[model samples]
Target: MISNGVSGNKYMDGPDQVVPSDTYISCVPGGHVKLRQTSRGLASEPPISVPGLLKRTAARYPDGPALVTKKADGKWHYTTYKQYQERVRTVAKGFLKLGLERYHSVCILGFNSEEWYLADLGVIHAGGYAAGIYTTNSAEACYHCLESSRANICAVQDKKQLEKILSVRSRLKHLKAIVQWEEPVDTSVPGVYSWAQLMEMGAAEPDTQLDDILKSISVNECCTLVYTSGTVGPPKAVMLSHDNLTWDAFVIGEQVGDVKPTVDKIITFLPLSHVAAQVVDIYTTLSNAVAVYFAKPDALKGSLVETLREVRPTRFLAVPRVWEKMYEKIMAVGAQNSGLKKNIALWAKDKGMKHHLARMNGQNGTTCGFKLARTLVFNKVHETLGLDKCSTFVTAAAPLSADIKKFFLSLDMPIMEAFGMSEASGAHTLSIYPRFRPESSGLILEGTETKFGGAVSPHGPGEIMMRGRHIFMGYLNDEAKTREAIDDEGWLHSGDVGRLDTNNLLYITGRIKELLITAGGENIAPVLIEQQVQAELIHIGYAVLIGDRRKFLSILITLKSKVNNDTGEPLDELDTETAKWVAGLGSKAKTVSEIVNTKDPAVHKAIEEAITRANKHAISNAQKIQKFAVLPKDFSNHTGELGPTLKIKRNVVYEKYKDIIEDLYKE
Candidate 1:
């Protein structure tokens, strides 16, 4: 029997209880109900496979645009579906010629690029397993992933990545070849293959053999091994079958409304290694044959503006941090502007808020004043931010602050918050446009099932457990961990803490493992506080909750940048001014206080207000952030306090600031 998992739970019984119309909406046109009323029997047929889905999609849209990237000369290069397929076959043939047999793992290490996607498809097309390492990973971390995956070949982007690979080449017995995308000054390393040479070799081969190989590839074969963005320790390689990825693309596409490339364009910049970017940007784009544009890494802001102006993309995906940054930049611009421009911007924002509130209350059309406000004020704001043409703006990876969500919605850009994990092929729940809850992560997808672990209080929270066809096969070579995560019944235990509203909309609270239990038995989720407080604090980059097994919650904050003064001015000014600003605080605290209060009052007040706002969202015991200390620098993965994905390594942070935390507790 397919275990529904939740026993004796009235809420788990039927579609009416699990999915209400008020909470969920159809992802397809005409808003037809999509979710099943009852769970399908265990004996039901399996869904279509990933490779088969790709082949079908390719056949359907052979002439459609598949990928676009900026050329070295700055012009955008477009690759059609037919051309993309040809390149994949050529790369696959090259891989086989290089002696990379089926199931032999190949790793790709780089930032977001067209080549990254190409290499990924090539590996899978060649019947080999593809793995991706974070660009920020150190040589040691790189070696650990490569060794763990038993990757024999690595496709690297440039010289820096090449150096990381070269550093550990002696110890990696399985590593037989290195494929460098960019031209290298020294190709002296044995078995190092240039990308150009490999393509040339593949071009010389017959196309018939490549076609046969692609056809022979099966759906059950492992296509990708994505290592978890290690927030604490070494990364775990999550094995994803072709079927897993294709199912994810199909489901996500269905949920977001059928995307037509002939009418829609997508901007791609998030790291291809990340599941959100991979599934949403690469696989989804390929499935639809949508025109996907690659933005330059160094000049992202300028590149984004240029790309948006040229392509006028209708859809885009971004993490909450990027949206937050956009908000900050817009606010900063308003702060700097004067006269009519400033008044117009502020007026438009007010009208936008009114329109947003009315829309939230189910008003179908905008008021005349709101329309005028949009044309005069918000239009400029949207154009300035390159979101004026966007039809869909998706936010994942982290929970968005309610205010931020509302702000975007006010701008007429509905921010669809989604919830998923690396194990679930990137999506499980998605907020459908025009029928979305600003606070909830929307209803679970049609084919997915969710169960609560225990009796969460009537409106309180519990662990979110899910089971679906798109769920990953298993973690590579780690059965114990796999069993620990996905039980014998098949439910993948998501480590998040969240609650379901009466309407069954899921509202994520925080990570279960990150929740701190106090000596007084009060539990606190640091992320909830961090999100609120960080929204307020412009100078603070990260905030770690202290006081585990203690009286109350305290905090350790990392400042964005060190400064000699509290004023929002550079410290590199005249020595006299720097010394004068640094002398305000008493001797013992002077040095640290000067470093902590770098930004101006507006920023400082924003942070303090965020803390206050966060407090209102918590209970009495969790409300008090009794004491706090700010470090001189931000926490970063390169600095060992955070993982590559910016998740704070709690133990590492605690260890690094043990003295400060102890002092806070004592105080």
Candidate 2:
């Protein structure tokens, strides 16, 4: 037997409970399970089911906009909280009416949109797991996710996604029906339903069956599945419980103060298949009653700024690549300025940087100089980027470069860095503005515990171990991997190596698997050296180190190049910013082939000087890049050199450039 728990209330486990340890207690509904127990919890808010939280938010903000969408009519539309809740109920009932079984899964494939959110929550409401597939995934990848999750129903955004599902439909024995949200779907295929048909089916079914399923819901049961990106190995299905989603969202909002209902809004375009987007764009918005506006399908191609201008959201979260692109665009445009305008802009940027740095160090930053700069230069930049109203700017999913951070700070827009993975639901350590340190992952969430494992001291560059109510249930259908991730002590061992400062802020160094060991027994984190090279050479987009067990380090570099708008494939032509920099180098080369085939002397000398300058900052000779080669083209998602979150796949890069790496190390 186990006692029910409320906010801040403590209860003891009975004989039936299988608590993981004495330090932690089980707060999950029903009998306490072994691996799901946690030592830390939020004292201010009670645990809630996903659907229950939606219902409460609807009651509190009935008329407030829950979802704002722009249709093909070229106009914005609003769905109030009350109506959003009603539609969710209708979809949930429809799922049950169409034979959705308890604990089964519904696979959703699409970009972020209203129908996507409805399907995600509706599946959870009807006692099924909602699994999202990356819109960039191939049909084979989709089949793997659907099979791993045991999906019975599939919901897709458009005909393109529907085609992929249909290609794999025959092999999936459990799949019963397919629902296409976007029209022009060939519904001539049997067992394929339209969005209108789904609603109509819900209208015909009674709510009693859905209500009964809701009554049997438990906060500890898995409601969603996040499949890993499989950069190194096969993707694992990350099982997230209802409590994990609700509790994580609550703490995230609490950390980001002043997130009031109907006031704060967010524009979400990041892939919802990732845990960060689901936590920030969906659950957190629901918890705070914050309005969410969906970006256009082609937002990443070139239209993201247009959407940002229209929405002007209060909070913005993006991966580092997005911010880097924005920085490059601004620099390209600034290059066109001349004379007094350029001088004024540079002066303003200097003042802005000094002002923010003063404030970051707890000094008084308000002065006439800063005020003038804000009015003259910083405000214009904000207006151009439509970030005038955005108070919180966050960067996550991968490590951000020091140069990029400094650039943003010079514009008086400090982008806070956050750290988390799918196993932790979403954010574990967050850096809110004013409370954030430069290059740190901010403070750990209030109800989470963190420690450095296998370290000689408390603050160490060791494996990060964390435990909290926000911890995920387990990997779906992989008990061995689950046990390996979370030990008997209930601490989820993150493979990331990091150190904590005296202020309790986290600074991630590198991943254990990504570490390089030299012949003389020196361990080096490649990212630091790679980032230094890129910082010194502003025209390069990627600098990948090529030493793991060798005597010294070498690198593979790529010049900044244009990418295919439709497929994200890297093109040989230099980008506008890079081309301008190249022209300034006294070279007439335009494409990467021109630079490589002709062995441009000016460009080669610049790269050598940049590397020599970068090596001056290296900790030791072994860590310094001894040799380097410029790749023919840049790395990108289409080439499988980068992951979905724009993180470099080191193994893939090494394999692709093995000959170049060998030539560098040849005696």
Candidate 3:
């Protein structure tokens, strides 16, 4: 039996319980009901609740380090599994004492931290759904999520986050209390509590009510709400049951491998509000009793490397942008080298690339040159990046370009790619090493089922459909959309175009919704074309394709520029790497305005040449870019041109640049 490795508990390997999802979420008549009632994969990995997983880990490894954090003294500290469980219970009791009703949401808005995890599980333990709002969200966006989730209590990390809620507190009709988990809270405000105060309240309350609620926790009910990044429209709350989270965590951990009780370590730096981070940093670690180190609040702002160097985690997962940023920094540093040092670096990279390509092609790549390269350069690069201990390197959330993948491979780092949506609880296909081909999303998770629909050929590209226990319950409170998402047969329509090769490796082509149709009735996937443009011109931050029943495709390009860390807005100044690249191209332009206003000949010529090179790789003449315009500013979360996950918001871009697009299409 695929037990959670804990025995003797009556809940362990117990029969599944079907809870009323309508209380917390609304689904089609048989959406979640059918999955819960199905016995196909349920017997493989038994439906274990989140609370049960926590309890099992605590009991199985009482002394294991569950959570690690840095203190004021700059020393790493840890909370043992036993302590973590107790603290979760305390936080749960506190929520109960604060009048959190059953199925109500305890929405959390903050960076990943020990308190973040505590409050998350605590809310679920108190019989409430734990919803997370993106840290980059505006007060209005926060208000929408809070109101939609019907949150009873909202947790913020610092004063800034708390201020967002405070600005719209009166509008949140269902919100009863606010807890500032990091900074001090002004308790004078009614219903405002500090982290310490929340814990104290929980400690004072009897465990009778909390314990009773925990006993009634069913695996079939929604416990977490993953809000989509809302690239298309208003964010839809994807309701995930205990089974969805726990089963995914267990199966994903098993697939990635190397996860063990207390031995492995992983740094939590990605936004936990995203499903990928939630599964990898929180649930996956809990499932395997792996130690989780919390990155600093400024982890995204260059400090992530410092934390990584110190933590030296055993496994690492990063979004495509993060990996790309690292690549840029490495490239910048390598440019500073000269003479024999540069020669050695180049030689090592050549050897590394050859070795990686050979291995990827199913050959023994471990030759003398590879060994020498590892000793001379690759090993040092790994040590500096603190990935020396990392066995599994994963990239997800967005598509990674082939150029960036090969760049990392040349440094002896093979980054695996996983593909899925929030609707599937993080990942459906994971690319593990030896089987991980560039741009391929590897194989589907063992228990999950995937098929291509509407394809002309059996293995041809089509809409990717999946069905399994890992599928989410439904979009909360939208029966129509839920029914639209999950068909009568219970298969979730991904709306993503993909195909499975003979080797069963899934390759994602593009989003069916994001496709651009020409007036000539030709369909073009913008992402691949956009990626090519960006790959050819590393200085381009974003390339948005615009053509929907238009004559031909045109693109809006943005130069790589600085961004306001506080606001997530792109700044006018060019980023350092972009500046260097421009200087290398014989251009004196330093800012985006300089290049756009001056139309610097060197910069313009370089971009045109790059686009020409990219177009040559297009399958057809209709797919090539016919015109382009450079935007004054880069796309950013603040400007609403990009989503929280850094994926381009195509509609927002098109609307914002309508005038320029019209000008480009003019006869």
lDDT of candidate 3 over 1-667, digit per residue (tens): 1112211123323214544332222442112332433445532766778888898999999999999989999898999999999999999999988889877899999988999999999998887889999998999989989998889999999888999999999988999999998766788988889999999999999988887777666777678999987765789888888888888888887888766679999999888899999988899999999999988877766788988889899899998888988887788789899999999999999998888888878896495588989999988998899898888889989899878888898898988988888888998989877777887876788888888787552322588998877788778778777777877667788888888987778998888888888999898989889999988887788898888899888888999898888766889999988998889999998899999998888988888898999999999989998888899899877788877667777788888888988989889
Model 3, runs deviating above 4 Å: 1-43, 455-461
In candidate 3, position 179 carries an lDDT of: 94
| lDDT (tens digit, per residue) of candidate 2 on 14-109 | 111122322222322222232333444563355678988998999999999999999889999999999999999899888887788877889999
lDDT of 1 by residue, 1-667 (tens): 1112232122222111221222111111111111222345421324444445556657887777778887879787778777777787788788777777656778899877777877888877776778888887889989988888777789998999999999999999888888988776356778888898778878887876655555555444357888887664678888776656776787777778867854578888776777888888878776666778877663233355666667777887877767876766665566678999877777777787777667756798876588888788777777877778887888988777777787777766778888998898898888776557787887677677888776642323577888765677667667567666776566778988777776557888767777788898877777767766766654455787786899878777664433333222223222332233233322222233444555334334544566776677666745577666766555555567755444567888888878777877774
1 or 3: which has the higher lDDT? 3
Pairs with backbone N, CA or C atoms under 3 Å apart (clashes), candidate 1? 50-243, 536-606, 536-607, 537-607
Q: For each candidate, how many residue pairs have backbone atoms clashing (under 3 Å)?
A: 4, 0, 0
- Model 1, clash count? 4
Q: Which one wins by lDDT: 1 or 2?
A: 2
Query: Least lDDT summed over 10 consecutive residues: which range in candidate 2?
Result: 8-17
Tell me how far the alpha carbon of residue 239 in candidate 3 is from the true structure, in angstroms, after superposition.
0.9
TM-score, candidate number 3: 0.93
Per-candidate TM-scores read 0.84, 0.93, 0.93
